[model samples]
Target chain A: MTNVKVTPLTDLHRASGAKMVEFAGYLMPVSYGSILAEHRAVREQVGIFDVSHMGEFVIRGKGARRLVNDIITNDCSRLAEGALQYSVMCREDGTVVDDLLVYVVRDDQVLLVVNASNIEKDLEHVLTFDRNGADVENVSDECALLAVQGPRCRDVLTSCPLFDDVREQVERTAYYHGFSFTHGGSEILVSRTGYTGELGFEILVPSNLAVEFWEAITQAGRDYGLVPVGLGARDTLRFEASFCLFGHELNDDTSPLEVGLGWVVKLNKERFRGIETLRQEKKNGPKRALVGFELEGRNIARQGYTVLKDGVEIGKVTSGAFSPTMKKSLCMALIERSAKGTEGVYEIAIRGKTATARLTPLPFYRSRAK
Target chain B: MSFENMRFSKEHEWVQFEEGSNLVTTGITDYASGELGDIVYIEFPEVGQELKSMEPMGTIEAVKTVADIYAPLSGVVREVNTVLNDDPGIVNQSPYGEGWFVKIEMSDRSELDGLMEKHEYDRMVGKG
Candidate 1:
């Protein structure tokens, strides 16, 4: 096997006593101390995640907005300057290429932040958009992103002089909005969006300043109970929020509509690639839908585990874990629409044994009010 | 604490042989439980089942991943710690005592000669 790539903060993670593991070809921290502890830290107070592995691309030149709009599912023209929108790029067959967050930095400048695994494909897709007076460049290697997320995130950022001028700007910047600011003598972009379903901010800074900036925020937020979270908690937190993961909940063969993200698709707008297939799917309905469930027993259903009803295999688990907050095994699955209403006890084929499971609503764990 | 009489395997299993009854009480070592995280479920092998050394006897599901429990010696399953069905967390809290997975009637006591002692197992795991 090829060697896994290490981020700039690899030493920091090791110093913090994080349990490092290979994930998506990167040697990343899976947990700092304990998965449950890190998971709870994000739910109650604040947690920081090294998200430098995600890909970032810059689209410049005139007609950039039009070109980007024609490529993505979301209507890019609707985004005002300094706003960000979540959308999906798709194949002609309506399958998702990648779900991305597009930032409208200026009328002619757009930034696309995509999943780490889909960087190459998304870059190729953007290049296929006819240019139309636009120039797309992949800038993933030059930038490092960090996420400080939780209810107490705003309070933590208040102490940084780098964020002082943008404090009010960030405070008022509603969800999915971003603003450019100077941090530690470097230009930084702060976005009030996160995948954890909590109020937080994502900061993009120069790769060189990543370690210094991470240490500064972590030290400042210590009193507020900010822990250096790892990808393990990141997955659990996102799973609890009903967010989709790249290969598990979504893939090149799964469309946004099939996963309950049809709201981002603009079917009526000027024709874009994959419009015909998506329109047809919208009318016919997806064959399978992503649904959440809470297993009755402690048996943790995992990816590729078969879901059974009445002793017959009906579907498969995409992502599953024992939720720290609820203290129960929870999962999300892509099952046939007909299996929706079938109640009573279901089973998950774990190993060679059939363990009983139950289907509950999504967001198995809800954040408590402070 | 009397691990001198107990034999261990590289997989972190410990077997304590009862001299008189020729029975073995098996449990995972503290290192195994710590690495596996909180134990959420434990599937025990049925009584009267014969198990070969190094063969999988049952499965243990933790919060992060599922691991198979291997037999440390050739034996016939005599009893299982049924309390684990309701309180599987015992494996994380007290693995050596109440977290014991099964008791077996030793079929081939010579298998113990192939297993490592606590000190040897520790050295193999780089913890000695």
Candidate 2:
């Protein structure tokens, strides 16, 4: 295995007694003290996360807009400048290469933020297909990101003296909108997009100023009960909201139609990778569908666990956990659409014994946001 | 917290075999809870169910991982702590008292001989 890269907040996290673990080639804190405590902080109050390991690619030059439009599933033509969009890039066979957030900085300049584990593959995908010849640069190591998320996020950010120049704009910014804020000669891009199903802001700044910015955010959020949450809570938070985790819910084998992400694929985009297959699947409603389930017993149906119907294997669990908020064991599984309305029930094979599970709705939890 | 009269297993479950008594209480160790991060669920075995030594009893679900609880000794379960059904977090807060998993009627007194003492268990966990 390669050496794990350290984030800018590594020493600070160690000082706070965080349990660090290897995740996506980065040595990141899984939790500080308690995963439950950090998870609650995000749901009830506010929490800050050091998400600097996420990769960013900058595309600019004459045909940048055309190049980006050709790559992603979301309609880039509809995006106003400074607007953010959640989209996916796919291989020719319609399987996901990576899901990313596209920040339309300008008509000819775009910033694509992708998952940390897929950075190399995403960069190669963009660079390999050089139809438009845009200057694409992967500057993941030079970027630092922080996500301030929760119900009280705006109030806490508004109270921060460090963000005074853009205080009014920050408070007024609508969801999926991003704008530049200048701090000490550097332009920090703050967006209203977040993985957690809550009102939040993701700030991208230069790596050198990350420490100072982290301290400032922490100082301002002291009155709002904000804490530094690690990736452990981050997973549970996103999972509860039914977001598609890269390797778990989504992978190179599953189509967007199977995971309920077909809405992002613009069928009228003229031409793009996997367009025909995605269109065909969308019309026929994909052979498989993703469904949410509740395990009747305390045992959780984790990833890769076989989901069965009448003792016959029909699907596999994608992601699952005991929800801290709901106090129930919830998970999402990918099953054949033909088995959708099976009244018998579902089961997960656990240690040679079959554990009963109940098929439920799509998402186990929904945020207050529309 | 008093392991003086209690015995432990390498799987991290603690057992207290009373003198000349057939019933003994069992609970997961604090070390196990700390390693699991947060206790979200504890599947208690049904009372009167027979379990074998080192065999799987049920399961312990945490936020990040799910683990199986092993029976420390061969016995028939007498009672399961129902308090954990309402709030499994109690296992993390009080692994020794209210967090106890179950009580079992030992089929054989010699089963306790296979269990480890406090210091022995601690050494096995690298905490000694």
Candidate 3:
């Protein structure tokens, strides 16, 4: 227990009657009240999440852009200052190391936001690939992240007087773009990005001021029916959106091409890690494909459940849930590419019984993010 | 119908035996419902299905996780509260009252002697 960590807002979550659980070695809130209610609040009204468990790293120096582009699949060189691009870093074998968001601060300074569980691994990967001696520092311990999400997210954000200095910029910040603002003696970064398929903003605050910033956002969101969401709702929200969570949709053995993230590969660009294999896979297609499916009934198809076609094992489930928004049992599975000819139907082995599941479109829920 | 006389299982199910009849009513405890967060679906055992003591009887699905509902004693399922078919949240809202999962005709009434009281069950779950 001594090795487990707690985010800066953990005490406040406990004070608000949140049910806490261990996730990625941190004792985080699973829900403040009901996960179903918290999920609806984000879809129908607004919600706030303490996502401070995510990792942050700042890479600076003359070789920063090159180091980033060489390590990640996306072309960071194309990003304008203040722009963010989602990308996956892979080993030479074309398997993913981590999926991250790259924030371009300047031509020579960039920030990488990574998965909390992969901080140590990602840091070591970046350092090892830093042929140009780029200064890479893990700032996760000093940073905290908060996400305010919903259709009325902008209204809720601008209502906070603390954001007066950047209210205009906040309203103008395009999707995937960010701007930094300073107050008192500290600085914060605000970006129009989120895991939920909702119009939202993620704010990177200093660890010391995380609670204060969260309180300000919560106060401003009260009139708009903002609920304090937890990790349980966070996962269901992203699952409905079909977002590829690192461990679920990707791992050291899964390539970006197989998980439907090929758009970020940018094979036409300069050589990067795993480019040779990804380029080859692009021409021949990946061996496996990720597809969305809905079960015939309410029974869930849990992660790692065996997927079968014609009574033969095809693959396994990656993520599954009873989507509160869709009101159905849904899952994403990684199946053999040859098995895609099953005529849109497959069988999922659930609790020792075969349950019928049918192929559905990628996202079961439509995004109102724009 | 007071829960004071109800016996609880180590698995967090509560069983109430009628004084004159062999019929027993059972459901998950309030602590079980609270730990499950928001229940979205429950796959109840079919009527007339035989249940063995401490064996899995059904499935309870919440938004985050799923767990098996275990039978507290040996019996045959007499009836399932079908209302839970469309409104599983009732389990989270009223775990003791309307959320009762099933009624069973006890196979061995002597099994009640091995069950725990509310206070002991609470102590086991660190609620006492």
Query: Highest lDDT among the candidates is held by which one?
Result: 3
Number of backbone-clashing residue pairs for each candidate, in the order shown: 0, 0, 0
Residue range with the least summed lDDT across 10 consecutive positions in model 1 chain A: A361-370
Off by over 4 Å in 3: A131-133, A342-345
Tens-place lDDT digits, model 3, residues A261-307: 99899999878999999999999999999999899889889889999
Prediction 3 global C-alpha lDDT: 0.91
**C-alpha DockQ of every model:** 0.51, 0.80, 0.86
State the fnat of model 1.
0.47
lDDT of candidate 3 at residue A195, scale 0 to 100: 93
Best-first order by DockQ: 3, 2, 1
For residue B45, give model 1's deviation from the true position in Å.
4.4
lDDT of 2: 0.89
Candidate 2 lDDT, A1-370, residue by residue in tens: 4888988888898999999999999999999988989989999999999999999999998788788888988788768989988889887888899999999988888999999999999998988676566899998999799999999999888998878888988888889998887888888999998877888999999998899989999999999999999999999999989999999999989898889998788878887788988888788889999999988776777899999998889999999888888877788999999998859768888667778888878677786432
Q: How close is candidate 3 to the true structure, as a TM-score?
A: 0.97
TM-score for all models, in order of appearance: 0.90, 0.95, 0.97
Q: What is the TM-score of chain B alone in each candidate?
A: 0.96, 0.97, 0.96
Winner on DockQ between 1 and 2 is 2
Best by TM-score: 3
Order of all candidates by lDDT, from best down to worst?
Answer: 3, 2, 1
